[model samples]
Target: MRFFEYQDRARRRLTLLLGLFALVVVLMVALLNILLLYTLVEPWQELRRLMPTAEMLAEHRGFLLWTTGLAIAVIAGASLGRLYQLRRSGGGRGIAREMGGDPVDAEPEDPKNRRLRNIVEEMAIASGLPVPAIFVLERELGINAFAAGFTPHDAAIAVTRGAIESLNRQELKAVVAHEFGHIRAGDMRLNTQLVGILFGIEMIALLGLGMLPGRRARSDPGEMRGPVWFNFALVAAGGIGLIGGRLIRAAIAREQEYRADAHAVQFTRNGDGMAGALRKVAARYAGLNASPAMVGHMLFANGAIDQLLDTHPPLEKRLERLGQPLDEEGLERLGREATDRVRRAVTERERRRREQEAAAEQRREEEENGPLGEAFGAVPGSLAAALLAALPGELARSARNPHWVADLVLYLILHPDPEIREQQLHMILETRGPESEERVRQLRAMVPEPAAEHRLPLTEMAFPALARLSRDEQRTLAGLVERLIHADGRLSATEYALGRMLIEHLDRRHGHGGKTTHGRKDPAGKNARHRENAARYLLATLALHGHPDDLEAAEAALIAGLGRFTGSLPFSAPIPEELRQASQSAAWARILDRALERLARMPRHDRQRLLQAMDDTVQQRGDPTAEQRELVRMMAASLHLNVPLPDAGELFDAGH
Candidate 1:
């Protein structure tokens, strides 16, 4: 699906919702002004003020100003306070915890949990996203799941026990894919914002509730009338806010749900799986109690209030869209397929385990040589599986063991050059102390080294463990890793990419400053000069680095890369003088960051062509050398594309 278009639409929807909120505030203010003016004026004066002939109502100007100010303060203060509460709760984690979900194992051992983990990991890697932490609501019997967080790395995926026990592998895969679609399309952030806004409105309703008990307690009958009127006004304002909030929620939720369903179909290429799961949801007639009513919109299906405050389209309509009608035979077949599929998965797992025990080495070699399918967009399941298999056993084990992950990550940053390695060791010793440094040093010696192709996968595996650290501990760890990477006095492509990924993921989890949505390209990309300039900077950097020894060949590569963009250029474009002037400094990192951010804003097709050009430049010397391959991979990762090293040809060829 066109991700950018989806994002643009989401932004527009957010704008519309905000406008609705402002309108509600204005209406509340107007109501308060009318009530306060009536309360203050003498009986005949109040009657005169209420007359339709009082067109401008110039005499009530003071009450209007006072009530408007009070209304604005109440709404703004409540909204701001609620938003702060949500932010402090750490995005989705707070919401999931509130729902009483227990954290599932990162690498689960229970057969059921393991099946779910595998499905989530497969979708994560396929979409070039971090494997989100999983949660399970074992007590809840309804089939439901949700994806929540400000960004992909920090996101959480939670499912009810009913989903796990009922849906087979393909059906569950479809469910998880739908959640991943939410993560990709920036729906989680928007949902959180909506929740905060609604909470503010709910606060007004609550205040009205609190005032009702005091309405009849006044000793003086005349005074009783005033409190009664005031309470009536409060209730009226709160009632409007409450009704308006739900209406807004229903409107936005219904549209996004449909988009998410389509996204799942596109990602998994299986309409029957999702349709079957929804059909099951309908047949079971179940509802989720995993989360509270406020979170109804975030679920795979509506939680409570499915009819009045429904967050999902009707099941029959969904099935019809997927071309799976509600025939009696089709329903029976779905149940049969679910049961048989589970049996097959168990048998397959047993058979694979036995095969692994007998010929582990042979299998490893075979996985390494197999074609690494589709590199640019969603990776094929086979390619993702192969990459996972290639992770070193020790590293994989450490990734699951939270206690060992810090030292393992520290060791991964150790430089290869002997002199630089010593400098890195000394820096680690100074910052982390002897004990922590020694643990990493000893572990480094024991672990088998990972190849260049295995770098990104190893990092991906370590993420769950990295997430285990407290926010402060993560900050310290990030600083130490940064010091070690730069201790060698120069940055290799592998180190640069790994460093970026490490900081990006950790900072996001800790709620540090990072883009909530993926697109960073400036609107100025429409300008021809701006586009060409960005192309020149990116192509020049790639060309100069790819062909360090031959200036002529470097210029040729630059021309070839730029040739892919709009507007013709000279046969050879000179490497911008800044590249040469700043070659000795770390300026290229900042330069590349700016260039790619601008380039990334382009349309998907244009970005693909740009990727193709870089591929062309890197392969100028027949096959790409190890250094060349590493450089390209890092560039792609920097651009938010996690492509497999060997699959670049097939990636571009398939027009992904």
Candidate 2:
């Protein structure tokens, strides 16, 4: 099913689950009221002797109403308080820290952490999502991990030390993929809500225990001890409610785990990797030393072994689902084989480490010999490699540091004209203080002028750190970016692209941003016209920007792009005169801005077509310019497309 479908279904399931929790609360309140009537309300102590009359009922009605109201208020109040706490803590990153996780550095010194970071980055790039902030539970020695967040934009992935140290590369990849599955299926949001609900239910038991009778002076011979019995009854009701809550949470969590496992297989296309990881988890099961009642439902495996309340399915059962059912004897053999593989892998890794060190030293020596010698080094092959080649080392390192990232962003968007740049620097000083302004100046001196291609990659690298900022800080940074972009009084395509990408990404991470709702039924009538006009505006912008000197070429490129959506759009294609008038209007920027807002809501298939059309427009005049490439990347980011940035060769060949 599509992501939006899963999201809608999850919402329905959440409502049902919450209703079950409410039923548990109602039962507890009923029990409390019964205790109050039987123990406290002394109405002649004889309901059997009393007449069945309206006046008799009216006499006890007030007392019964008071007891029920108090019980509900206590329970509902506790639940709302827990929900408030979760909200204040800032979603996934906050949950990770609360569970004793430390943020993994972008350039980690530990080899294992580095490996985990690389794997996450690779998966994120392929999945077309922002790279989630990674954290390590340094104290946890259990093979477990979890994804937490309200939405994909703010998601965080955390793994224990044992998970990284025990699992090999493929096994670790499978585990991470399983968590990503949760993010994609909208399980993280549901898991977070479950945490709050379970906590509220458990509060009844805690309150009862707090109120239990303690050592007291000897009571007089006829003193009432009914309150003592009342306390015990409260404890009993609370215990039953807690158990019911756990059962409900576990049932829902078990089904989610199975779905996540299926997603892992789909993502990796290898069942053995996930199956192997599960077997190892079974063989080496160490409990997580955290609040099991609150976090268990979100973990990769059940943290404890309560059969009736375990959040994960049995390991054997999970293996069976993965097409690797094994008896005890087979499990033992697999465990032994896994141990042997780890030993061999360690040795191989050490050898590769040494080789890499030698290669790095050789490159340093070559780089020292000048550009000619540097050219002898390995050629840029992949997107990552090309980015590294284009970005200066200092700028790249700065992008990874949260302290310097905001400054880096400011420096990248400074106006090219000296007078305008000085105005921007002055604006930064007034708004962000002298320290920030100085940092931006220092960055400018260090890089002098970065190439056009390096801008987006640098911004992309800064995302994890950007996510670390508080909401207010992100908003301030966003404001600063906007002002700098418009400082020259005219927005370049590059400037609009860069500013839009930054603001949109930060907005989503703050949990208030609008998410793409793909696979929804297409809009009809007026809405359809609006969408068509938005598409036209975008295509016109790209064509005019790419071929600024030649109007004939611009019109041809525009037509070529529009042809991709010929049958799909609601309205007819615009003629050359219309295109010319639209491109020449002074309100072109405002039009493009509105167009982007509309296009961002396009369905998944429509988005893919739009991207293809963009590529066609860029390659209409042989090779695309640097400015053209940057604009395309920015446009894709603005639309929240999951695909990687297309290269020049891909752009040229995409038209066919």
Candidate 3:
């Protein structure tokens, strides 16, 4: 449906809700009238009877009492029907069942619906987003998908089984990416709120119905004559409330679909693929709709959005809104066009990225000898390779819990103090730790005997033991350790320290030096010198963030940062020239800011690093110092820009 059509429908629904609220007020009034008759007229009738004026009193009260009671009873019957609709339109269980997912995570899994899970993972990697929960609809043949969740971390995407089997990888990616667009753009929050408000609109009518019985029960016997008039107004009010709410929810949610569709196109750079996917579903309309009642407001296209009844724009119109051709012959063209268009787009994007990387390399070389250079940019190439290699494997696997790998990151970072190393060794010696003799034997059995550790330190042995697991298993295990370290809020200091250490150790054990020359520039090139300078500047900025008060601590931070990055890409693996530089600058800048902000917030500590950065700054430039220059370097990296060298006067002054 066209996005605006959904917006219009939601407005209409809200209007309906307002109308229904008025009806509920009227019904409530009718119920109140019945009670008033009992409390006022019926008692007065009895009073008149004792005074021998019964006939006069009875005639006055009878019509009004019966009228009020009748109005409430009629409204009750009509309101019950809306409740059934309330259940259906809510899309609560129908959606859950279709997705083969339980609203509650503890529900047993259905073995038949695993495809939904796999598609979500692939799309997430392609789009550079974390994976979302996937659900399957066993009974649905409709090619429909929706993204839902309160937050990105908890978001869910559900598609029918037909969607998976019917669409190829690209189309599936298009659809999933569309859903993520909704997730990213904050449409899901708006969507969830619509559901909540619809429920609130119903609450008033339900309360009105609940009050009806009590009104009837307490009426005085034979006191007031029934006047059916009051009850008539009551019933009219309730009907308006029910229909009004359905329109409101449908209206608000429908409009975002177009935005989501366009976002999917942007995300995949394949308009025709997304358009074609929609076109294919529209062509198969006969078998592609859920029950109108089940998908009423939740679907991409309404099941019942016939020209006359639907709140959404008609299907042909929606396709046109996306500039897609309606016929089958055109769909094939769109498919090929989309593929080529995306390939070209990807190539261009990669090219722009490479150029940026090359420039960053030059900047790094220029900044390397600057006061802050060494602390700034430098990641080992091997770690970058591992990250790239990990991506394909991570995407292809089923039963992914990347969080498990994330958790193990802390373990991988394990470079414990000597005491901690000894403790690790003793734990291994106890024959209880997993790194003990038996595990070593198992490792020897699995790998070449030459590669097995017979006399290595326990710290060294622990990592290879982990790497021997099947790739997926290793990810899972690493993810577990990471989880433990970061269990609450941020990872504990000890955890962070250890995780980095272990990461370095593992890289070493695998004969993988984190350093690589993939994106390094030629030595004689001017750009090469600039790139070297940028790395040095990046390190200095990071070293400052570590609150290094002396050369020793500053040097340590430089080592850690260099060790962490060095010859590798800051984030991704297989460093392109443009990305490596941009990454080096971007990462160095971010970590610098983050680290500095962390230290800045802490109470003044007399730690060696703290004293080091302080005294070192004072010594470099006397008195007020070039702290401002350092600040500029720190901030420049944060903005992903190289700080042009200022003259000596700009950096330091002896005026004081």
Say which candidate scores most in lDDT: 2
Residue 535 CA displacement from its true place in model 1, Å? 8.3
Model 1: ten consecutive residues of lowest lDDT: 369-378
lDDT of 2 by residue, 1-656 (tens): 23223334545665687688678878877676665565566543554543435554467788768977876676677767876777677677888898899998755645788778766654553344566889988777667898887666777899988788788877887898788777766676666666676666566667767775555513442343565556666777677877887787777787777777776664454678798788787766546788434456668885566777787888877888777875676666755655565456557655876877866566545432222111111124345434545567667656666777788889999988899999999999998899889888888887788888778767776788787778899999999899888786677667777888888788777554553322234354128677766877788778878876777787788777877754443333443343355423434566676677677777645766888888777777788886787788678766656444443344421111
Off by over 4 Å in 1: 1-62, 212-227, 303-308, 328-382, 414-419, 429-453, 514-574, 581-583, 590-656
Per-prediction CA RMSD (Å): 7.6, 8.6, 20.3
lDDT of 1: 0.67
| Candidate 2's TM-score | 0.64
RMSD after Cα superposition, model 1: 7.6
Tens digits of per-residue lDDT for model 1, 231-295:
66767776787677777777677667766776666556567789878877765535675456445
* Best-performing candidate as measured by TM-score: 1
User: Deviation in angstroms for 17 in model 3?
Assistant: 13
What is the lDDT for 191 in model 1? 72
Deviation in Å, model 3, residue 295 alpha carbon: 7.1
Clashes of each: 0, 0, 108
Q: lDDT of candidate 3?
A: 0.41
